[model samples]
Target: MTPRRAPAERQRDPERTKAKILEAAKAEFGAKGYAAARVSDIADRAGVNKQLISYYFGGKEGLYNELTASGYRNNSAITDPATPLAEVLRQFVFVGPSDRDAARLFVWENLEDSDVGFDAQREFMQRQVEYMRARQAAGDFPDDLDPGFLLLALISTASAPFAFARVARAATGLDPTSPEFTEAYAEQMTRLVKQLAK
Candidate 1:
């Protein structure tokens, strides 16, 4: 008698398939922004049928929402305002894998004005702002500086490696994702913010 396959062996690798779809969606969304990205395009890039995207994520909007949610969760996991500012900044800037595609997709979605993913993005940003304010009140940051400005400065420094890698390379002849660069930038920015707060 022929050996029977296990139930798990017969089942599709849902996690792998979902990861592929998400990777494809990240590229398409980053390239086209949410309003212009097409579900068919993501399906094609993932080498899966368009129906599978619908089955797994409902549609393009759902996929975008999932990606945004994942990005927010990743950022939240690393951020802790209670920590010393330099340590917090370092983790935010360089602790994660240097997944440029994922980072670019997140930033692109965040900057776009389209309503498809704005609610979740706005909520995430508001939470961050509130966190910064709380830290300021706790004497972790200076009260004289506006919380919004401090938030933007922190975001810019944390996101610079992703947002300005090309410019950084051309100007500094260094890989933005390199440990040396992240360390130097984190140190410099931390000092700058500390001085500014005085």
Candidate 2:
């Protein structure tokens, strides 16, 4: 007879399973928008049974929510209120290629406008508004400028490259992931902000 496994060993580890689902979901969703992405694709990427994806995450919507929610947590850390805006912007722009998938997922969600996608997009926008208000109150931004517009401008400068790769390539002649490009872009934005504030 086969030996019985301990209960701890036998029981499914939900955290590990959930993480696997999220990782797969990020890749699949990044490559294919929410409307086009398939649960079987995520399950295949994770090397898990399709039923496991449903069992752990409830469905594609749940998987997408988990990934986007986690992205917010990760991004919020880097943009913490205590961090200098310039430093935060620098890190935000130059944080390397690993974040490309997250960035892609963000762009895809914004383009699709599904319920789960919109929630993530709304949270990001709200955070940007709060950040802009804080910067304005601290005199880091122009007093005469609208905080909302300034925030939108800053976000555009930082994120446009990720969303519009062709434009970024044509104007900068540098890949979005290049260190030189990131540093140059960050410096340019910093100078612009300072000039505007003055």
Candidate 3:
């Protein structure tokens, strides 16, 4: 007799399966919010068994925490201290992974009052503030501007285009998720930042 297979669903590579589950979870959570999203739905979307999700992530809460870490706000590799802040801002807005769906997930996470590790992002923002301060001290950026406000402006401007993509598309008859729209938006934002320089 031939050896029994472990079942077709269990044949996937572990990393790929984990990634698919996360992607599916993000979509479900984004659309339905955490309160209503179902693990079975995520499994259906991912083409995996629901048991795989629970096995890999310890269920929804653990999966959500992983997502919080994956979002743009928690990304530690995107920043380079040696790179100019303006360039960093541009990359973050345009070239970085377009995590617009994750922005929607953030909305759900916030409304549910889940401990999604907002502090991790705050720590990253604080680093940006320090970077801006250094630039201001060097007479490159505006010295009169508050670093906190500058950091806020940078992140908010970068995130808003994606966060409000549907609204923007509806309001302007343009697809905010499209590269053309995002590139133009980032250019405008970069120009606005440059205008603030001393």
Q: On residues 1-198, what C-alpha lDDT tens digit does candidate 1 reach at each position?
A: 999999999898989999999999988987778888889999999999999888999988888998878877777755565665656666676643366677677678667866877777788788888777776776766777787788888887678777778987887788887878877877777776666445
* List of clashing residue pairs for candidate 1: none
Can you tell me which runs of candidate 3 are displaced by over 4 Å?
Answer: 1-12, 72-74, 95-97, 107-113, 166-173
Q: What C-alpha lDDT values do all the predictions have?
A: 0.78, 0.77, 0.74
| Candidate order by decreasing lDDT | 1, 2, 3
Which of the two candidates, 1 or 3, achieves a greater TM-score against the reference? 1
Count of steric clashes across candidates, in order: 0, 0, 0
Question: Looking at candidate 2, what is the lDDT of residue 47?
Answer: 79
lDDT tens digits, residues 4-61, model 3? 7768855769999999998998889888788798989999999999999889999877
lDDT tens per residue, model 2, 57-129? 7888888887888787777767666655666666766643547777788778878876885676678778877
Q: What are the models' TM-scores? A: 0.82, 0.86, 0.77
| Worst 10 contiguous positions by lDDT, candidate 2 | 89-98
Alpha-carbon RMSD of each model:
2.8, 2.6, 3.6
Best by TM-score: 2
Clashing residue pairs, candidate 3? none
* Residue 34 displacement (Å), model 3: 3.3
What RMSD does model 1 have? 2.8
